[model samples]
Target chain A: MSRKYAAKGIFLLLLVNLLLCIFYVSAGAVNISPADMFHAFLGDGKAEYQNILVHVRLPRMAACVLTGSGLAVSGAVIQNVLQNPLAGPNIIGVNAGAGLAVVLCSALFPYCYAVVPFAAFAGAFGAMLFIYALARKTGASRMTLIMAGVCVNSLLNAMADAVHILWDDTLTSAYGFRLGGFSSVNGKVLLPAGILILLVTAAVFLLEKELEVLTLGETVASSVGLHTTFFQFLFLLLAAALAGASVSIAGLLGFVGLLAPHISRRIVGEECRFMLPFCALFGAFLVLLCDLLARTVWAPYEMPTGILLSFLGAPFFLHLLLGRSRRRRKKHD
Target chain B: MIRCENLSAGYGEGAVIHDISWEAAEGRLTAIVGPNGSGKSTLLKSVIGQTSVERGGVYLEGKPLKQWRHKEMAKQIAYLPQSRNDASLSVFRMVLHGRFPYLAFPRRYTQKDEETVIRELKRMGISELREKPVSELSGGEKQRAYLAMALVQGAPVLLLDEPTTYLDLSAQMELMELLRQLVAEGKTVVAVLHDLNHALQYADEMVLLENGGLKQCGTSKEILQSGVLEDVFRVRIHILQDQYGKEYYGFSSEKRMRNETGPAASGHPKRLQIRS
Candidate 1:
């Protein structure tokens, strides 16, 4: 029965994702029709329509899908590894760290696009390690880990702000990316991000069993013959890669990481085999929908995707926080 | 055949169980009993290589525990901690995790694994709750579910820490009897128990620990005769026999109570703390 629901859920999500993709492609600044979008998809559209769809909208859409899926899957993996419902790339400092690295690369080595993503990846990994170290030092409780993430996030964000202030001339180019939108996305960013997302998402799928066992907590996971330390490190590395790649493309898109996996888990239980793919599709659909609104809402003016996400995500984050505390209080009673 | 040779282990800086040499023979239920903070759980954890060894080592079969691959060790020894995180997994899925050691990378459970999980659920009397989330179960039911998970590992050696801690009287007895049945089926079971009477009644052999040290290791009868329980726990105990001649150990804080209340408290009946 649940399997049937799961199938229906997947089908519905795919349909929504397809429709959103078409809407995003067709309703943009150039207003390509559904026929033209279909023709572009088939590689036989009119030349100008094909160029607009292929070169501009398609890469932007691909960036949205890749970044959205990567962040959401990374969020799911981090939440499992840390055993904290609130843990994710943005809250846990991975995106801030990546953003800091991107800002630093842009300031120091202007126009070197390839170096930015790698730096972002390295920064994300470093931030994860930093948060882990802090959590370990403080006994790694849920509250302590989140607190550590907050500290790392603030520190990295401040550093990025400092870089912006110090190198004010580069701010114009770096500002939009920092706020996280698909405006700057082209084949250069999309291609590499797409490949990395595919690889890491597959890798996460392969680690599905380990991730599920890990949700049982470290002691039980280790006792059950999982090399808990090794797998934790590997999962963290994969999460960092995913989050870092997404941050490079989308520039600190918050909440999708936290929001999408959570919604997927609610729809399909915690089994990663089902949840992971669902999270990816759900995440893509969400970002595409949000981006479509961002584009068409006020016409010529566009809201940054990150700002829209924060507005949507903050209340949800607070709700989870309060709900967790309330549950803990009830358990005590 | 699990043996600890002067095994000294602990967390970060200090050894919790120091230089404890003990052996759990095959096909017997061995209970490690001690007062709170006596390192009973630490000793059990050390046996499974969960603790940091400061000195000496543990051996499973004949090989040093460190030499055994984690998967190989998991195939031989199954361990259950005193407490587990409230993971929201179904009973069937939770039990299936026991097959992790047997499954290779891209770890998909096989037909045999599913069968074993089902069998364990039935054996633990939780087959009806296979689809139920563990978090929704009663304390006793949760313990049974965890036990089912451990049993499905199919290991010859089972180590459980305070398996009956949060259970009611009947649930405690049921779990102990289940462990005994496992022993009867040729599995070696080592459990850390807080209830001395339960340990005495259910364990074939008992190890008594006091202040991070091994005080006794022998048959329950031998440990009873050794008079270590009173000394280690700092309480006086009396042995009572039922009509069937089954002996039960009962504890009293009478001596301390008398000291506090003075000589006038002597004629008053002493309260017996009976644990069944």
Candidate 2:
């Protein structure tokens, strides 16, 4: 394709993403009219109206979209870098590691709410460091990396459980986040988290091609001047950072990260550039729509969107795992 | 030109392909033949600066292999290593990976790269499978795709490790013919071949390596001779000429050496040589 055509395609995607953001703002529990939403959008001078529409709904919605996109993009990156279909958002236990750290820090240092995200960040980074060090010496091997990730995930979860056992009262928030629902986040927490996710995911877009090359096994990647080791560490760090941030704010919403990218891959083609952006949009939409369902389905009482997602995502995951293999054989021949 | 001087490689504390010195001239096909664990693959890997057990470096052009940037080396030497894991990529994308060395950040393929990938897909006879998932392809089809990726790298020096490892007779002939055509186009193609007859048909030259040592390096006609074959293989080989005047050789087992030595020493090798 020509450069002009590709640019136009990307511009169209951006336009659509923007439109979705607007729609997301317009839909919610408060039932704010689009005119008033737009008025609030334009900084209309009604404090109560602005608080209901802009302060409450818009930021949470933005958080859903950005986190959804961010986590999904990171999932796509992880899937390619590790070369495993099962390599979803928490494949490396980033969420668990972060959860463990947050729980430990929050429980042990009760006055450290701000440090929770940072603790999670440190925990996630530490877990990745351990996995990469153990599994990857010079080059990253797929099975070794996945095996290491699974081990770290189990170990960290155990530690998280240990922390919960010690501080049983604070365990509610910790466990809630671990299941990965988005209800707890307000505008105050969501805004900053959203910005961070957007920036990091943008960086992932930049590294798309490098990641694609890295997918073809490390030996080939190095032969082609991809700096396999450097890129390996770079991608893992970036994916973990974004995922850590997502976990800190939203807890452990499972399906958005894992399912979004796979669905987008089937839709937009396997090329990383095509897959990443669509995955991001779909991720956000899925979470927001699910959250909308959670709130309205049992009005005044909310089901965790994570629970709703798993209800839907489980079947899709099974189909992707089982059906793809058999269908692929017939199609290729 | 590619040169390996005093090259030694193996796992920690020991060496496999030891103190080997050889050169692959520009625009020539050189096949490496050796016993199992003889380190033909290691020797080829050292040339690309990939071997973890490198005691000494291989040089490309005039620079030490390690000194040259991997992308620079890739622009010169493309490699097709043995098949191990199946990638969950498309055939088109697999070939596109050959152009990876030329891509920078935001790494979209250029028109030129795309054209080469397309041309190579056709050349390797996998053009129809371009959109199909790579893992779903048959073994021969997979090997062909592997060859296409190497070809798409567009490097002057090519190294293939056992290009026909599991191929049937026709598929084996097909791959050999592809290599021959590559050499005819003035591209240097070095493939590790197990079948001596296949090597004899396609390889302009052969480097026989046995027990981590270079036994002989010369023209295929000279290296495929009964005396040289026996020296590297330590097996009785009877050469019979076909009606088409082609020399066909077979290995005959006579000496019972299994009880006389270590496991490594007594085993019959599958790959006479396996270059990277």
Candidate 3:
């Protein structure tokens, strides 16, 4: 039953994502016609059109898709592993952790771009480990883990702020960094991080059954022969890697992680096999549309994509919060 | 057979059950009964390696629990928790997870696995509810679905904790009958029962516990004859004969008394708290 729903949902999502991709590529700052866009995509258009398609538009589109899908899937995994609806990469400071490393590396190295992605990965992994260790030491519970994530998030954000203040002169993209945008994305960083995200996301898809079993709760998962603690850590590690890779490319894009998976859960149901792919496509589509709006809304005066995401995400968060409580009240009465 | 040797276990540093030793014999229904907070559930947890064992360990078929891989152990013993998630999954999919232990890498379900799930669902009389969400089922139907899931594990032994809690009388009796059927089919079954009458009437063997200690481990007849139920539970036990000379166990608790002269003394209807 889920399979049929997933198949049709995936088809529609793919079609929407494909249309959005074409619109995103064609309707940018230097608008290209459909015929010219097709010719340029095939690498034989007018020189200027081809150059814009290859250098500026294509890379930016890639950045949005990668950042969107990567963050969304990571959020889904974190939500499942932590067994909390509100938990996400951004909520738990994973993006902040990666952002801190990127800022510190850029500040210290100044010109060396190769080390930023690795530094981001290391930082994200470290923050996740710290939160888990704190929760474990305090006798881990669902509440304890979320509390630890809050503390770690605040601490990491504070450190990132300190770095920004200290290296105000050296870092040129400080403003753009806080308000994540694709205006200045480097293909050099995008390539490696994009590959990492794809590999990690594929790995998550392959292990969908294990993930589904984990959602049955710890006792049943163990009773069914899953190594609960090991699987939990493994998934958290994957989530960190994804958040790290995404932050490496697109600064600190929040809310896609939280919003995409949540909306996907409603559309595709909770089974990971269907939900994972649907989430990836839906997330890519969301970012594509949002980035398009960010670019074209105030043409010649681009808004940061993250600002648009926050506008959509913040209210959705409150709605979920209030709706959940209302449902609980109804259940009680 | 399942055995616990000098098992002392708890959640963390504090031991809830201490130095307890008992064995659930093969092809028999062993009911672990005690008052609340007497470590009845803790003992069940200890057997499944959910708790921290401070001193001893559990054994399955003469092998220490630590020696068996988790998947292998799952193939030998199935457990039904007292509380379970009402996951928003279809009943067919939920029951299919019973074949989880046998799945290999990538963990896709096989044709045989699906067949087994359908067979178990039909056997539990829940085939009509296959497409329904597990969370939407009634209490009795939900329990049946969970039981079908456990049975599909194909384990030789089964363990349950408070399987009848929150269940209506008919539902409780139905579940108990199902457990008896499983035991009669040559499966070892262990359950922690809150109702002593159910324990006394349904179980083949009884392990009476009090204050985290094993008061006695014997046949139901022997435990009833020993009179430990009255002492531990602080109740009066009565045996009545039916028309065909069949014995039925009844209980009267002083805890619910409302007057000085109880039902035994004044035959006051309101003062009587008889459970049979």
Best by DockQ: 1
Q: Rate the local accuracy (lDDT) of all candidates.
A: 0.86, 0.75, 0.85
The lDDT, on a scale of 0 to 1, for candidate 1 is: 0.86
The weakest ten consecutive residues by lDDT in model 3 chain B span B265-274
Give me the runs in candidate 1 sitting further than 4 Å from their true place: A41-44, B254-276
DockQ score of candidate 2? 0.45
Q: On residues A1-333, what C-alpha lDDT tens digit does candidate 1 reach at each position?
A: 165677788888999898888889898666888987778778888889988886888888889889999999999998998888899899989999999998898899877777777788889999998887676566788887888899889999989989988999767866786678887775665667678888999999887889999999888898889998899999999999999989888888989999998999889877777888899998898888888888878667888887888888889999999999999999899
lDDT per residue (tens digit) for residues A198-287 in model 3 = 999999998888888888778888888888889989998888989999999998887998899899988888878888998898878888
Ranking of all candidate structures by their DockQ, best first: 1, 3, 2
Off by over 4 Å in 2: A1-24, A43-46, A104-118, A137-151, A161-172, A186-191, A314-333, B11-13, B104-107, B238-276
Q: What is the C-alpha RMSD of each candidate to the true structure, in Å?
A: 3.2, 6.0, 3.4
lDDT, model 3 = 0.85
Worst lDDT run of 10 residues, candidate 3 chain A, spans: A135-144
What DockQ number belongs to candidate 1? 0.75
Worst 10 residues of 2 chain B by lDDT: B267-276
lDDT of 1 at A285: 84
Per-model TM-score, in order, reads: 0.95, 0.85, 0.94
Q: Is the docking of candidate 3 incorrect, acceptable, medium or high quality?
A: medium
lDDT of 3 at B192: 92
